[model samples]
Target: MANFTELINKHIIVIGGGAAGFFAAINAAEMHPGIKVTILEKSNKLLAKVRISGGGRCNVTNHCFEINELVKNYPRGSKELKQVFSRFNVSDTIAWFKKRGVDLKTEPDNRMFPDADSSETIIDCFMYQVKKNNIAIKLNEEVLNIIRNPKPETQNPKLEVQTTRESYSADAVICSSGGHNNAKNYNFIQKTGHTISELIPSLFTINLPGNNIKELMGLSVQNATVRVEKTKHQYTGPVLITHWGLSGPAVLKLSAFAAKDFFDRDYNANILINWTGDLNSELVSSELTSWMKEKSLIVNTPLYEIPKRLWAFLVDKADIPDNKPWNELSKKHLNKLAQVLTNDSYNMKGKTTFKEEFVTSGGVNLKEIDFKTMQSKIMPNLYFCGEVLDVDGITGGFNFQNAWSTAFVAASSV
Candidate 1:
C-alpha cells in the first residue's frame, strides 16, 4: 500500500464521460487535491445521458431517504446496494450538488431534478466542476484495453490504459463506462479477465402492434395494476398509453423486473391490466352493484375515478351498449363489466426503449465487486461503478441514484 506522501502525485484515470464517469472524476479530484485525474470518453459528447435524462430535466437522484426503501427501487443489485447506499446515498448526492451551487427540486413522484428544470443545468455544473478541479477530459479517445502491471509487495499495482489514440499509465483506474446493449462493446473489459453478465434491456415500453389500444394513445391511467400473464411480475402505478404501447412508471417497472422473462419469451406475451389499482373482480363487482340503482346511462357514470374515455372504452369492451341504463343491466352484462374493469388484457408483441435514456439490466457481475469500496474484487486498483456494473434500477431517477452512489464510492476508494 502506498503511503499518503507517495500518493500525492498519483494519477487516476476514469474511463467513460457519462454520469458515473463525471461524478467519479469530479469527486476523486475534489477529495484528493494533489492527485492528477483524467477522463477518457469514446464519444465526442460529454454527459450525453445527462443532457437528455428526465426528458431534458436530468433527474439527479430520488427523494427516498430510507436506505432499505431506496434499495427496493433497484431490480438488480438490490442486496449489494443496501450497503453501498449507506456510504453515499440520495442525501449525499443532493448535498454534493447543493454545495456546488446546484439546488435540486423533488417532483410529486419523488424524482429529484435541478431547480432549473433543464439538463443543461447538470451539464453546466459538471463542466464547471471539471474546470475548477483542473481535471483533463479527452473526447473521442476510446479505451481499447487496460493492462495491469505487477508490482512489489511494498507498492500498489499500476495500470496501463490503452486508448485508441495513446496509452497512459495511472496509479488507479475507475471504470464508469456506462451500460452497453451490445455484448461486443464490453470486449475491452472482458480481455482483462473480468466476467460480464448477460446484457439485457430494461426500462422499456411494451409494444402492442395491431392492438386497438394504440388508438387511445396519449390516454393515461393514474393508478393501474399491470401484470404479465402466467407470471408473477406485476406493478401498480400510473400507466401511459403511448402510440407505441404502454409506458409510464408502472409499465417501466414491470419491464425492468421482467426483463429476463420478456427476453425469454421473445417479447411476446399477454399483459393484464387492473384499471382499478388494487381492486379485484369481487370488489369491482361489488362496486358495480351499487351503481345499478342509478337510472343514468352506464357510460355516463364512470366508476373508480377512472378517466371518462378509458371507462367508455372498457364499457365498449364489455359489450355494454352506450345507451344502456345501469339499472337495466343483466347479470351477464354486470359480470363482463366487472371482469373488463378489473382485468383488461392486451397482447404485447415487442418493446420500445427510450433511446436517449436507455438502461440495461446487466454488466460486470456484482459478486466480483466490493460495494463498500466499489473496487473490482478480481483486479487490483481497478474499480467499477455506474451502469457498467450489473446494477440497474427502474425509471424515475433510481438509475441515476445508483450511478451517483457507486461513483462516489469508487472515487472515495480510488
Candidate 2:
C-alpha cells in the first residue's frame, strides 16, 4: 500500500506482450508518469491474439453498456467482473478507444470492432501509446519466476522478475501473461503460492467424425437450438455445418459454458440439434401435417425457412422419398420427418478450436485476486489480469473487454 509519493520514480514490469500486457504497461506508465514500465514477451510477435481476433478485425469490446447484461457473456468470472466492470466497463472501453482516435463500430451481434475493419488499427494504437508513454517492450524474453523482496512491515514489498535471459526488479509486477492450455505452464505463478485452477479448453466447435453432416458443410441455419444431450446446456442461435463438424455462435457458447463438462466426458458426448429453433415436436408435426395438403414434392417444398439442401437432407434422413408428393407422404414418414427436424442427434467425438481464438476456462483462481485492483491477495505488489485469471467469456468481444477492464484496474492500482 504505497502512497502516491512513495510510488514516484518506481519501475513496473508487465509480463506478456499480448492484448492485456500492452494495455497494462501503457496504462501503468500513463497513470503514474514517474514510473518506468517494461513489457516482457515470450513470443517474438506481440499482440498475437489481438492480431487474429474477430477474424483480423480485433473485436475490441461488446456493445453492451449495462454492466448486468454485459457480465452475462462471461461463464467463468461473471461474479467477480460485476465489481470489476463497475470500475471500468464496456462504455469505458469504448470511450478509451475513441479518445485515442480509434472509433469502434458495432456489428449486428453487438461485437465492437474498429471502424477501419483491421486489427492493425488496434496494434497501431497500442504501439503509439507505448511510445508516447516511453514503455519498454522486450520480445522473446520469457518470464520464469517472480520473487517478492522482503521489506519492513511499514513499507510495500518490491518484486524481482526472473526471465529467460536476465532479471529485472520492479516496484510492482503485473502478470497479464495471458492463458496457457497446460497446467505446468503456470508453474511460475504457482511458485508464488497462488492456486491455478484446472485448465480446460473453452469456446470450441463440436467435431463429428465420419458423420454425414460434414457433407453439408458451409450450410447454416439462421436459428437453431443446439443442446448437449443428457445435459442442461443448450443455446439457440445460428448453427453452421463445417467440414469438421458443427460450429457457430451457439456451439461456441455451449462449449464455453460446458467446458469442464466436455473435458470430464473427454469431449465424447451426444449433441441434439433442433434445426427448427423453438419448435417442439407438436409444432413440427403440425407443420408437416399442414404440408400434407400440398401436391409438391416434399424436398421441393422447404418450410420453416430452412435451406433447400438441408431440407432435402432431413427428408432423406427420415427415409421419405425425396420426390414423393406431400399429399402421398405416409403417417410413419411424417412422424420421422417431425422428429428429424425437431430433434436431430449427432455424436460429438472431439472439438476444434473456434477459429484462432483459443480461450481457456481456468487460470489463477479468482479467489486469490482482488478484482478491484487486479492484485494478488497472496503476493504483495503482484497483480494479474486477462485470461491469466479464471476469467473468460464466450466469443464476441467479451474476453477482450475483460482484458481491458482488469488491465485498467491493475494499471491504475500500480
Candidate 3:
C-alpha cells in the first residue's frame, strides 16, 4: 500500500544522529508525510551524548520562559539566537516533548528533565517517532564529500553526498555535523562556501596545581564569588574543590564567558576567590571582632556559615595557633585571619574538560546562514542546526535548549 513514486519525489537528508539531527529528521518527516527522510550518522551509536548528559537524566531544556533573558546564557550566537529562539523557544520545547508523552520536570536551578528522570525515556520517544514516521536511519556512513548540483537556473537545486560506503543524492540537505575541533572535518561544509570559525573549549574547569585547597577535595561553598584577576570576568554561585582544582557552576560559567581570554593566557593566571559571599571587608572585620569578644576560644568557634574544618584550616594557614583565646589574639593575627577569610587567591596552571559536556565555542560562521529559515544565505536548500553553527551555552541545560530551539526551527522551515 506504499506509494513508491510519491516517496521518490522528494528526499531530505539529515547529517548527524545527535539530538539536533534526530529532532530535525523526525519533525521534517512528520510535517511532510510524502517526502522521504533519512538520517546518516558516522558513528554506530545514536544520541550517545544524550545518554551521558545530566548523568543519564537527559536535560531537555531550561525552565526559562522569557525570550530576552534566555539569550543571555549563550556565549556565542547570542544575537543570532535571540531571533531564532523567538520562533521556537523553551515553552515550545516543553510542549513538543509533552505532546509526545514525555513529561519534563524542572529542577530548583531550572534544568528541565523528563519526569521519569531517565535518558532512555527521551531516546525511546525519538525512536518510536522515527519508526512511526518511516524515517530511514543509516549508521557508520561517514560522509567524505558533498557536491552541489551546478544548475543555478533550475527550479530546484539538488545535492550529492558521498560516503565511505555509498552515495546518496537529495533535493535538500541539513548539516548538523557537530562541533569538531579538527579543521579538516569541515572540508565538506567548506565546499559549500561556508567559513569556519576558530574553535575553542568552553564550559571547562580550571586546574590549580600545588594548592593545598585540594586537601579539601569534596568541600563545597554554596555561594562564593570568583574573579579572574586583571579582567572584568566574575561569577557567584556554588564552588566545589576537586582533587585537581575547582569545579562547579560558578567556575564553569566564568570559564565559558572568558574562554578566549583563558586560552590567550595559556591557562596561567591568578584567580581571587571570596570565600564569604559578601565581600564587605568592614562588615567582616566587625563580625570577627564580635565573635572574638563573645567566644572564649577563637579557634574552637568558627564564625559565619563556613564549615568548621575549612575554617580551622584557614585559621591555621593564617598563623593562628590552637587553643588561642580571643582576648589573647594579636592585632596582626586578627587582620591576617580576616584577610585570609575573605580574600583567598589561587594559581591556575591549566584547565580540564567539564566532564562529558565538552562544548566548543566556534563553528560555521553565523553570517552565512539565514536566521529566519536556518538556510544558507549563499546556497539554497542547504540548512544548519545545533553546535555545527557558531553557538554554545554555559552549563545548567542551556546548551541543550539551544539545540532544541535551532533544530525545531530548521525542521519546520525545511
Candidate 4:
C-alpha cells in the first residue's frame, strides 16, 4: 500500500515510543494512509513518564494563546520553540485533541487535563488512533545504528535502522529519541552522531541539611519570597517546609530555571527566605514592635502571629532569649531577631528529584532542526522531537506541550 519508489515498499520508522514518537507515528499514518508506520521503542513499555506525570493525572497542555507567552515557560530552547509554537500552538492542540474525542479541562493555573482526570484517557486516545490507522508499535527493539544510502542530486533518501533483533529500512526516519539521563530508553539514539548537551538533573527540590526547620514539616505559608544565596533570582509564591526541606510552587519554579546552575555547582546552594515577601523593613519593624508588649512572653512563647512552632524555631535561629519582655529587649537583639525572621537563611546540601516526572534540559542543539517541520536543516529525510532537543519546561503541562507541538510539525511536513 506504500510507495515503493523505484525500489521496494514505503515505510516510515519512528524512533522512541514516548509522546512525540507516538503522536508522530499515529498522525503520519492517519495522514498518508499509503505509507506503513512503525514505532520502535527501546524498552518494553511506552509512555513511562506520561503514566506518572502530574501524579498520573497527566497535565496534557497549558492554555496560552500567544506564542511568545507560551515559549517563556521553557528555560532552555526558548528562542527555537518560539518558532515551533508558531506552527502548532496551544489552541491548535486543544482543537486537535477535542476533535479526536478527548475533551480537556483547564484549571486556574492554565494546566489542561482530560475531563476524566486520568492519564488512561490520554493513552487510550492515542492508542485508539493508532489502532484505527494501523500503526505498528514495536517494543524491546533498540536501535543500535542508522544507515542511510547517500542519495544523488534529486533522489528520495532511504534510511535503514539496525536494531539488536533486525534491521528495517524506511523512506524516512523520525528521530524522536528521548534524553540521555533516561537510562533505559534513550541511550541508543545518542550513538547516531548527534551532540548531547551536558546531561544534568533538572526540576528537582532542594534538601536542606543540618537545618532544624525539619521540625516544621508540612507547614505551608502562602505569599512568601525565597531567595538563593548571592543570586538576584528570588522566587515568589507559596512555600512549604517539608521533612526534607522547602517545596511548593515557588521553589519548584526556581529549581527549574536554575537547574543547570545547581548542577554545575554540584547541587550546593543556600536559600534565604523572607517569611513575608515584599514587606518593607519599616513595616516589619513596626509589627514586631507592636507585638512586643502585648503579652507576657514565656521561655518558648512567640510574640508574633506566625505559626507558634515556626516562631519558636525562628527565635532559636535568632539566638535570642524568648522570656525577655519587649521593653527589656536590647536594640542589638531586635535587629538580630528581625533579620532572622525577615530574611532567614538555609543551606542546601543536595537536590531532590520530582520522583515521578524527571526530565533533563540538555539535548541536541535546536539550531540544526527546521522549526517549521521539525526536520533536520542539516540533513533531509531526518527529523527530531521530544526531549532529545534542548527543550524542557517547568512541571505542569508545558513538557507535553512541546511533545505535541514538535510532532505536529513533523507530521505536517514529513
Candidate 5:
C-alpha cells in the first residue's frame, strides 16, 4: 500500500460536467500539474446548467456578505454549510470569476451577473479554465455506475465508471452529476452505498387543477408573501401571477422550503397569499378605509395602487357587486374584500419545474463528508462536490456559488 503523498502520480476521474464537475476537474488539475485529470460527461454539452441559469444572464452569486444570511437561503443543510461557507462565499466566488477575466455585476436585488449579461460568459470562463489547465473532457460518456469493493488494488475502493460505450477506472472519483430527481444521477450515486432521501420535484411553480389561477394572469406584486400552511413555511419576495399560476421569487422560494413536505403530502397543499404584503391587519384596514373615504362615490374597480381589473376580480370573488360604490361598503363587505386582498388562499395541487435552474434537495449527506476538503468520509481517495451530494440554493446565483466554493476547497486540498 502506498501513502497519500506517493499516490500523487495517480490519474483522477471526475464524473458529471456541470458546475461542480468542471470546478473539481479544473481545481484538481491546477493543484497537481502532473496528475492527469479527466471529466466524463454523459451529455454532449458541458455546463448545461450554467448555460440556462438566471434566464441566461447567469447569476454568479448573491451580494450578501454575512455567512449567516448566505446559509439561510438553503432550505436543507444550512447549519452544516455555515462552516464551509465561511471559507468560501459570494466574495470568493466574485474574486474567482474576476481573476479569470469574468467580471460580474450586481442587480438591484443583489444577484450578480457577468458583464456580458449572458451565460456565454460563464461557459467561456469555465471552458477557458478547463482548456488552459489541459484537463480532458469526455462528452457523451454517460457514467452508468461505480464499482466499490471492500478490498482492491491500485487505489482501494476503485471506481469502475461505465458508460454506454466503455468503462474506465480512476484513483480518485468525485460525483458532481447533479441530483437524484434525474434517474441517471440516482442510479449513479445509489451504486456507492449512499441512501437518498425521498426525492421529489422542487423549486417549481404551483399548478392548480385546470388552471384555476388563470383568471389572475399577468399580475405581479413586487412585495408579496406566500405561505404553504402544511409546513408553516412562509416566503416573501417578488410575486408574478403567470398564465399557469403563481410564480416568482416568493413562490419559488416557498416551493423549495416546502419541497419535502409537499412531496410527503402527495404534493397536495394550500397556499396563503398576502398579495398587498399587508402584514399588519390594522394598517390594511385603515388604508382600505381611507380609500373608501376618499372615493366614497367611486365604483369603477378600486383604481391605482391595486390594478383595477384585479380589484374587480377580488370584489367579484367577495360577492360584492362590481358596480357598488365604495360608500356603500358594509362592514361585512369590507372584511370580505380585505380577506381576498390581504390573505387570499388557494389550493396547490402539484408542482411544475423551473426549466432554467432546477436543483435537488438531498444527496451524499453532508454528515458523510468533510466540507473542508469535500472528501468522502467512508472512502479514501474519493471526493464529492457540486449538486451530486444534496447541497442546493435558491434561483439567483447561489447554486453557482456552491459549485465554485466547493470546487475551490477540493482543489486546495488535492
Candidate 6:
C-alpha cells in the first residue's frame, strides 16, 4: 500500500486497444503498482484482431526459441528484432500466458494457439489481467493528436493527448494503433515527429480470376514449390486452389516476403508452380519413364504424390489422350506431361486479404525508435509498437510475437 502512494500521480496513456496496446497497458500497470494506465481505443471493440486471428483461435506466437531464427520470420525488422527478441522471445511468451492460466499449444507448423482453441480463451485472460491490474479502458476515445511539451525546463512536462471526445495528459505515451494500408491514417503519429514507411498490404492470397485453376477449387496440394517468375522470391509448402485464386501457407509466405514487389507490379505477375515438389527435370523425366514402363494405362495410373483429380487435369492440359496406355504415350506426349507436371505456371492479377488478419508491410521507420526500449528517438517518452512499427511477419504467429516483444520492452521501460 505504501508503494501505491508513490505512483498515484503517474499517468500513462496507451493509444489503441489491440494486442500491443493492452499488453503494454497491463504490463506497465503491473510493473508500476498504483500507476494510472489508461487505454484509449479508436474503436468500440477490444482485441478485435485477437478475436478473429487464426479463424478465432488467436495465434499467440510461434514456437521458435532461437533469437536468430525467430527474427528471420519477419520480412522487416529482422536485424532490429534480433536483440529485442533475445530479451523476450517465444519461450517468454508461452510462460507469460501460462502464468496467467492460459495454456497455449503449438501446431505442427509451429503456430501457437490457446489450448482451448478459441480466441476467447486468450481474450478472457487479457481482460482478466487488465481488470486485476486496475487498468482504465476508454472505448470510442480516438486519439486525434499528441502534443508533447517542447520546453523541458518547464516544471511538469506532461504529454497532451487530444481525443475525439475530450483531452487527457500523460507522463508517458504509447502508440500501438496497429497497421494501416492508407498513409493518411498515420497523420496523428506523423504529427508527433515520426516519419512512416510506405504501407502496403501483406500476407494476401493471389487473385487469378478467370484462370483454369479456379476449376480445381477445393483441391489442395500437400507440398508445392511456388516461385514468382523473374524474382528471387519463392516458397515451398501446401498450396490451396481457391475459387478466386491460390492460397495456403506457401502463397501467404510469398505474399509477405514479396509484398512490396507485388505492390510495385500492380499485382500482375506470373507464378511458376512445381506441382510434384520435385523440380529436377531429370528426376521428373526418369519418373515419367518409369511410369511408361509400368505396362498400365497412363491415364488410369496417377504419377507421383499429386492428387488424381489434379493429375487428370494436368494430363488434359498436356493434351494427352485419356485412353492411351504407357506404351502408346509417345515420347513427345510423355515429355509434355512431365513438363506440365513439373512446371505449371499461372498468372496473378490481384490479391485478397487473408481472412480478417490483414497485416501491413510498412509503419513508422525503425530508425526513429530505440528497439531496446521501444521509445521514439525524436520524441522523449513517446513509444511505438506492434504493426505500427514497420515490423511484419509472414503468416503464422510471428506478427503477434512482435507485438508481445515490443510491447513488453516498451512497458518495461515505462
lDDT of each: 0.90, 0.90, 0.86, 0.79, 0.77, 0.89
Query: In model 4, which regions exceed 4 Å deviation?
Result: 1-9, 152-155, 182-191, 280-283, 286-306, 324-329
TM-score of each: 0.95, 0.94, 0.93, 0.89, 0.89, 0.94
State each candidate's clash count.
0, 0, 0, 0, 0, 0
Ranking by lDDT: 2, 1, 6, 3, 4, 5
Better of 3 and 6 by lDDT: 6
lDDT of 2 by residue, 176-199 (tens): 988888887799999999998899
Q: What ranges in model 2 sit over 4 Å off?
A: 1-5, 151-155
Clashing pairs in 4: none
**Per-residue lDDT of 1-414 in model 3, one digit per residue for the tens?**
235566558889999999899989998887777888999999999998888889999888988999889988998999999988999899899899999999999899999999999999999999999999999999999887777787887776788888889999888888888888788888888977899998888988989989888898898888888879999988988999999999999999999988888989999989988788866656777777776655477777777667777788888988998889887787788888888877777899999988868898889999999998899987788899998999999887888888888887888787
lDDT of 6 by residue, 1-414 (tens): 227776789899999999999999989998898899999998899999889888988889988888888887898999999878977889999999999999999899889999999999988999999999999999999898999787877764789999999999898899999999889889999998899999988889999988887888999998898889999998888999999999999999999999888999999999989888757766787778877656677777776678788888888888988888887778888888878887788989989988867888899999999988999997788899898899999878998999999999999886
Q: Please give the distance, in angstroms, between residue 242's alpha carbon in candidate 1 and its true position after superposition.
A: 2.5
Candidate 5, 1-414: lDDT as tens digits: 345466556778888888888878887777776677889988898888788778888888889889988888888778867777887888888887889898989898888999999999988888998889888889888877777553755466666677777877777787787775755557766666666665656688887777545777887777788888756888887888777677899999988888888878787888888877746555666666766654443346563356666666767777888667787787788777777777887887877787645677877777778887888776666677777667778777777777777876776665
Task: Name the weakest run of 10 consecutive residues (lDDT summed) in model 5.
Answer: 295-304
| Candidate 6, residue 395: how far the Cα is off, in Å | 2.1
Residue 339 displacement in candidate 4 (angstroms): 1.9
TM-score of 2: 0.94
Model 2 accuracy (lDDT, Cα): 0.90
Task: Please identify which of the two predictions, 2 or 3, would achieve the higher TM-score against the true structure.
Answer: 2
RMSD each, Å:
1.8, 1.9, 2.9, 3.3, 3.2, 2.3
Candidate 6: Cα lDDT at 56 = 88
User: In candidate 6, where is summed lDDT lowest over 10 consecutive residues?
Assistant: 290-299
Please rank every candidate by TM-score, starting with the best. Answer: 1, 2, 6, 3, 4, 5
Error of 3 at 350 (Å): 1.5
Error of 3 at 155 (Å): 5.5
Residue 275 error for model 6, in Å?
1.1
